[model samples]
Target: MTYEVLARKWRPGNFQDLVGQEHVVRALVNALDSDRIHHAFLFTGTRGVGKTTIARILSKALNCEQGVSSKPCGTCSACTEIDEGRFLDLIEVDAASRTKVDDTRELLDNVQYAPSRGRYKVYLIDEVHMLSGHSFNALLKTLEEPPPHVKFLLATTDPQKLPVTVLSRCLQFSLKRLSREQISGQLKTILESEKIKSDAGSIDAIARAADGSMRDGLSLLDQAISFGAGELLVNDVTDMLGTIDPQGVDNMLDALQDQNADTLMAAVASLVQIGGDYSQIIDALLLRLHEIALAQTDKKLVSDSAGNMDKLLKFADEMPAADVQLYYQIALHGKRDLPLAPDPRTGLEMMALRLLTFQPVAESKPVTNQSVPKTEPAAVSNKQPASTSTSQQPAPAVTASAVTNTASEASPAAAIAPETSKNITQNITMDSPWTDIVNALQISPLVKQLCSNAAMQKDSTFDVSLVLDQSHGQLLNKDRELELKKAMESLWGKTIKLKIELGKPSNDTPAATKKKELDSKQHAAETAINKDENIQALQESFGATIKPGSVRSRV
Candidate 1:
């Protein structure tokens, strides 16, 4: 008995067994069924994406003993021999090794000759892009007028390297990289047939590590099976792949959501003990954040391969959407700068701390005059009153610090107003100036852009209506409208009804006004530079020219 690796053992023998690349399969099947097969067929894609396998299957279809059809009869002598790689008429060439002109000419020497065993003399060239220029020229001559009794099947990872002359003569089929879900499904099916026990986490880990290649997935599966001593387990697979456990990722995220620095550091300690690349850990975090983001938009878009759908949905609800975006950005930059850090762990810790430190300011509750406690002003005097009936008491001296503290205590509402203004613009109403309001709103740039392009319409009611010019209608959407409404409500400290309509505004929008201001400033600056005494002297004395678009407004 001998052992065969999964990559080879589970290789797709026919088009039906192939995973992904359905577009290529459908086209080839239609061509074969219609008996309209071209003389030359080129398959292109990345490795393990079934380029050569498809070429082999197409060869089987062409030379199958029964007849030319999409579904070849495997029981036939020609099919079996082709499957075993011993068919007489089916010639397999490694274009990489035999790229010389002589080798190519010799390989095609028998192109005009009739097949001794099968109906057609099929040529299967793997990595055909590796052929030399002269070899391509030699092949191109035969391809232009390939004999009716012959067929050419070419496969390559890099089609851009192939000459157009060779390309025009062939029917090209591009194979697509398999998705992680597709690879994971295939792996599960194979494991079931092999009667190997495994868990979802282990299979998912391998699928992600595959990086969209079925062959790579199978290879990792094989390695994982052997490493686990026959049965695949999550712990063993994570150890083999050196990936943090999903629970460990969950713990880190939990610590982040709770703003628990101690718990976050503890999570890092656990990862350090597990021992893997910090960048990879960051990748895992980023992947989970992406899933959470998708879950926020639509739970259905988040795939099961991510594991723990319920937790993802929960995180999506518990975490603010803005915070998700912020964390994702930080993690991306942190991973890029990880190499420059003093140590991997230190870099990861700093990145994690950044996530906690820079979270979006939480929305504040509306405060009323009744809820605010007021304190009476303290009286201070440098001289004692002599009219007291009891013992005369000396007046206590008051310092500047004491006065400041007393003032702060007396007006808690005044203290909170400034902090509230930083997070959410206040005092905005239907009659407020749109330009000033647009500049003051604490919102994302995109939402701000939407608001800036809108002009407020006069109305007698409390509801506010914004008339957006038709030119900027593309920026109007339900999400942006909702965000704008929320921002206005926060600013006004009351519920606001906001309506956005596409039309011509009677007055210039904030954006248009700002643009006009900028243009004026730019023109003024350029005129000032042109009329400057020193600039004119240099221009006349040395023939110095001012570069176009060099002048810019300072304001």
Candidate 2:
């Protein structure tokens, strides 16, 4: 015997041998067992996903020597010959090569004759979508009305290219690409049966690298076995696939969570030492952030085919849910924009710095005042008696550093008046009561939009009648209504009945009013900035210009 590749050696001989196509198998098997066989069967899917294999197996089932059923006896001449690809009755044609009208006419010329050896004369045309328009026209009549002893089996990777007439004439079975777990499990079974020494992690790496194709997975497994000198090691598999270690991804995430720029650089440095791909490294980090976000919602969502749930859960606990969401968005956007950078390393470094930049300002430690005297602290000296300060006066709030560090800190007293105002606003009786309520309600944007478009009317049976404008009716679905009702109960500390009706609202929605106000303020700010003497001087002297829509009011 000669050496056979894993893909060819492990080719599925029957429907039961196939993996991850139970739906198609069940339909074909039921059809065969009931003897309700269709004349033409079209199997469509991507490369190495058993499109041709299933067509062959169905041909075997149709022409088996023992009987015409789903279960073919492999020992019979018809089945064995068909399996060996030498069966006279099974005419396999590669439409990719023979796609001219003459070849199609020659193929159809034999339709008048019957099967010489088997029960059905099967024409298995692979890549049938490659056939030309003229070729399809030549065979249309024969395909639609073939002889009683003939069967047509068509396979194509791109079914979209096939003509509608041909598509309508056949019963189509679209096979799905296999999952990573399914491919991994099938690889493990083959490796074990071959007496190969391998770990589950190595097989899993190979399976993912295969990208949803079983034959591709087995082919990669063969290459991996050769590369590993007969034993599949996880390290060898990672090197073979050019995949980064999950631990490295975990470390990168930890450094990002701490906002430690040096640690992040060190992580990248280690990967560079090992010749890791920057694109793959960024992709892995994005995947980890996604898993962390999922874990935030449900802790058990932290799972993967590589069994890295522990790392996911660890990062999920270390990072805030808000930070995870923000990082996930940034990393996702960076992946697409990475190519725009001058170099891969530069792109990766910029993304790492961006993660640290967007970190919450509140999380950063407050800078100590070094200029204050040994007797008193700056925070206290600002409020101390002027006599006690004797020599050096405290810096004024108008200082450069104070303006630069505006978002870093605020007096606790600054927020007290707003809290009091909020309490007051909740109590006032006004015509447009929801404007204040919508601002204060801690609901989602959708529910807030739903609330903003609604007007309140008193009813005997309900706490309030909400009249949502007909234009915003789509926002007032059952789930959103329930969320708003729950938020209402939470806000008021009372269970209140509410009725929702769709009609024209009599007043402006809060969102619309807020937008209108912001537009006016923005216009005023733009005007002020443009009219400034210094700005006009810079533009006239240096040809400098301010960006459009960049002016926003502090208010």
Candidate 3:
């Protein structure tokens, strides 16, 4: 006996056997049970999404020997012949092969005649979009009005190419691509029924590689079983699919979190030995990063079926959420750039290096006066002898005022200075301006933006009150608030109790102050430009006029 491929062997025979098309199945079942079926039916979706299969099943339902009902008796001659693809009344046409006007007219010529054996003559046209304009024109009239015993079933991967006249005459039911979970569930069921030795990890890898297509998933499963010598193994499937092992991805991520470049390179070398596809490798890494990011938002959101929830949660706790997002973006771009690189290996290596080079330095222990570096400023003249008199000039001492000013100059929020560094180090009282505290804390831009739009006040020694502006209410969330609270507590060297409320700020927010400072600087720059002697000369000699909004502050 010749072997049949899994895709063909496991084709759905009825509505109940079909998976991940509940909407289409429900409508068709309703129509059949109520005996209100339409003359023409059109099905549209991507490849491998059950467009042709549903058409075949509907054909069976309409022509079943038991009667015209949704539930067809498979043992009946009409159902058995339909399932065997030998039903005389079921005329299956591949529009792609015969797309001429003559072919369409010839097929429709017999539509007025009654079905020979079954109750109805079912016309199942696959890839109907391939029909030419003349063919569609020929099909329009018969498809719109056929004999009492005729039913038209048209299926296409591209419905947009179908003529509006033909489309308007049919009751279209679009089939959706199956989700990963849906596809995986179906695969598990098939494996159990087949008694195939398989594991969850291998099934998941195949399902993910399927990319929301049931036919593709079944085809891949067939290949995987053959590759594994009649058994499904994770290593064999990963190798067959050219996807990296989940453990390998985890190792690379662990090395990255540790900032161990050597370990990361070693992990890559192991992957090279396995001969995995670089593009798929990057995709796997990106998927892990996405999971880590989601886990950071909420640990419970991560799926446990992959047997890596603990690893993901640990990564979420150790690696900063910002780094996860950054790495994901870099990997995504790197995947796109892989094909243009000199070679796949070089592209992946350079991308890994870029990730390492740009990763932000881990936060250091709280900066103390003792840890601050003291050194001489740049010499005025390089022409002088090596040590003629540079050493004789004592370096200026670093002061708290200088530190405060230097810190304030680093960020726009630092424009509102309230206390010296020495005072803040010794004691951070409620009287200290929120801007000053915010400027000193190390946090992500999202948390910083949240702080910039809120007014902070002290309710007790360790209690803080925040009034967030109503305009930026969307920024108020638990994760960001927790991150901001942690940064502030670290800077103050004490645990803080925070209470947030949505309303108008009693004082100007840091964002408002920054805007004001920016406007003042813009006015100063414009005034200076207007008063410049060279500018005046140019205006007088050449009638040159400064364009509005062109002047920008350098300071």
TM-score of every candidate: 0.65, 0.63, 0.63
lDDT at 277 for candidate 2?
85
lDDT of each candidate versus the true structure: 0.77, 0.74, 0.77
Off by over 4 Å in 1: 362-555
Q: Which residue pairs show backbone clashes in model 3?
A: none
RMSD of each: 23.7, 23.6, 21.5
Off by over 4 Å in 2: 295-304, 360-555
* Residues 294-372 of candidate 2: C-alpha lDDT, one tens digit per residue: 8767775543465466666777655666567667766775676678777888777666655654543232223122222
Query: Candidates sorted by TM-score, descending order?
Result: 1, 3, 2
lDDT string for model 1 (1-555, tens) is: 787998888888888999999899999999999999899999889998888888888888988878999999878988889888999888999898998899999988889999998888999999999999999998999998889999999999999999999998899988888898999999999999999999988998899889889999999999999999999988789899888777778888898766555687788778767886798889889999999989877888877787666788889876767668767877887787788777888678767755554543331121111212232113322243546513333222224444454344234223212222343245555577887676566655556667777898876563888899889888888988888888777777789877888999888887788667657865865685555443454346434455333333434
Candidate 3 residues lying further than 4 Å off, grouped into runs, are 298-310, 336-343, 360-555
lDDT of 3: 0.77
User: Model 1 clash pairs?
Assistant: none
The order by descending lDDT is 1, 3, 2
